[model samples]
Target: MATSELIYSVSELNREAKRLLASHFMTVRVEGEVSNFSAPSSGHWYFTLKDAQAQVRCAMFRGQQQRLGFRPGNGDRVIASAQVSLYEPRGDYQLVVEHLEQAGDGALRQAFEKLKTKLLNEGLFDESRKQPIPLIPRKIGVITSPSGAAIHDILTVLKRRFPVVPILIYPVAVQGESAKFEIQAALETANRRKDADVIILARGGGSLEDLWAFNEEIVARAIAGSHIPVISGIGHEVDFTIADFVADLRAPTPSAAAEHAVPNQAEWLGGFRFMENQLIEKLRRQLSQHRQRLNWLEKALQIQHPGERLQRNAQRLDELEQRLNKAMQLTLKQNQHRLTLGSQKLKQFQPIDKIAQHQQQLQYLQQRLQRAMDLKLVTLKRQQAGISQTLQAVSPLSTLERGYAIVQQHDTSKIVKAAADVALDTLIDTRLAKGRIVSQVKEIIRD
Candidate 1:
């Protein structure tokens, strides 16, 4: 166990071989016949770089393909700048291409130059045909593969800068045999819908053959004919296509296309706030002016109508006079009632009324006194008659009427009750019932 050798698995051995080969041949220029060429949906190109002796598997990633100047055919001879490496998963030796160019006659390059010159002479790439990008687009239309990194980068940038803006995606193949037709059809669809304010034709960086769709005359004409503004963001900054020349605007990358499509939300918000403050200040000034005008109008109306003040004063005087008249009438009625009540009280203290009452009372008292005197006189007469009748019962004059005699001395007027009682007088008078007689005493007789 102390002197045991290090063991290696198949994967470890392949990884070690890849590392060693990559370090030894960082950069190499190889001449080969292009064969078994293919470009997958990932924007990576795979082909065979071959000579008469041997052939090597070659891979050109999307990023490194951007430096390719011309398209390579199956039998074309080319020089490819590449790195030697082992594909660990397959344990296969390969070359990773960074740049590719045609070798001897450069027919493809001459054709590219000829086409560019022809288009330039026809004014297809004139600056006058270019339109300006809108400051803020309502909707941004994108044409690219849905799964491509170009679309992802474009969407991420658009969301970060202005999330409120709407986006419409038109999925299409950005490469291969049908890529040109699909791109042209997408441009036509965008124009028919008229929904997007600006159209962006985008794809990640790639070689000339990988980006051949954008170079097609049909795609270039579609971009030129679009009513909506078109922005081209195809390969990297170092790469350019015919679509880039015909589009209204050209951006170096897909993310840059999105940046050019919309303004930053924060900057727009700041501008709106500033405009709001300015509008508020303008409104305030207008309101102040209106208030000043109103004040001036009110003062002018007051100064123009001096007679209105006199008319109001006259109306007030009339109202006060009516009130005074009503007050006087009410006071007169109250005083009349008081006077009537006082007159009734004064009648009770008047001397004339008191004398009249006293005269009636005195007349009543005199009538009562006269009646009492008459009653007293009649009562006294009745009492005197009764007394006369009682005295006559025993009176001598009454006895004379009854034939009884009363005797009296003539000189002394003495009456005799019996013969004995009357002594022999010198002369004795005797009175019969009707007459008196005088007799002398001749004898004293004893009964």
Candidate 2:
């Protein structure tokens, strides 16, 4: 045996290394931060687990990834329970991760939290931005995978609870790499079509990676901007996505989404039956009350008799007539007494008796009238004597007897006794008390 010179090819050496590693470390738990974590199209995750000094390659198969609560991302510190193995083709040592947990702050969880905070600050997660789900949506648009169990669950619930509400499905990928874009496009289509009153974004329970499409910023914004109200029914009750925050309503399950969108037929029917019974009872009570009121009114009308009222009025009229006659008799007696008293007073002041008693006064008046006439005759005689005296005092004959004359200017009818009254040789008139003479001025005399 050539114990000193045994040779092996690279493939054989790699195979031998894999077998040795697998036998020594069948299962192990390692804690490190993930670097370059990636899930390719092959449904397998390849990543590097590194510490400060060293690093190791880790592989998670699709079956294990599906069972993980959260997806691993770059810089994620995690405790990975894996089988130590070597890649024959690549000639590298690696860890085949069977289970994993957050070692410290998970990279995926930190990213999720940071994005959530950013969206919240932008008002995308605000209650004011969230719309109200329709109580009775006429048409519901569902954005989900065509083959998912979520659709079937929602349809079954809606059909059983409210069959009248119509549902339209917009099929989209709910998992894997293309899921985010497909979900966003489905939401956009539902909005453009305007065919539905409300929209439902739903999926069955899955790992965080499987549910990542709902957490994408594009999908979250689409849900927030949709004119129709959105109900997020993604994953199980324990799982929450960003779409749940942005949607108008969040339902724990697909069935619960249907229940939230519309009211249950059985419950509605029960309420309607109760209301109907109450209405009927109220009507019966009202009718009975009205019937009682009618009977009372009939009894009251019987007590009001027109003939009796007229008879009572006539009795009152007769009593008033008797009182009026008594008043008239008393008035007549007072008038008679007043008339007798007035007659006695008239007898005391009778005009004929007064005339008879004043006969002497009448005689005195006559004597006074006679005296007045005699005095009038005497006063007339005195007045005639005074008139004679005044006529004697103003007599022109007396002046003529005194030899007085009056002269007048002939043309101007003015007295011409002075020389200035007339020019020389002017015509003049001279008058004695009894006569006048016409003369021409021959000489002037000064007085």
Any runs in candidate 1 off by more than 4 Å, and if so which?
Answer: 1-101, 104-108, 307-447
Q: Tens-digit lDDT track for model 2 on 164-282?
A: 88889999999888999999888888889898999889999988777888888889988888999999899999998899999999999887887898899999999999999999999
> Candidate 1, residues 263-308: lDDT per residue as tens digits?
9998989999999999999999999999999999998887555344
Indicate the worst ten consecutive residues by lDDT in candidate 1: 304-313
Q: Give the TM-score of candidate 2.
A: 0.49
lDDT of each: 0.83, 0.83
Off by over 4 Å in 2: 1-106, 307-447
Best by TM-score: 2
Q: What lDDT, from 0 to 1, does candidate 1 have?
A: 0.83
Worst 10 residues of 2 by lDDT: 303-312
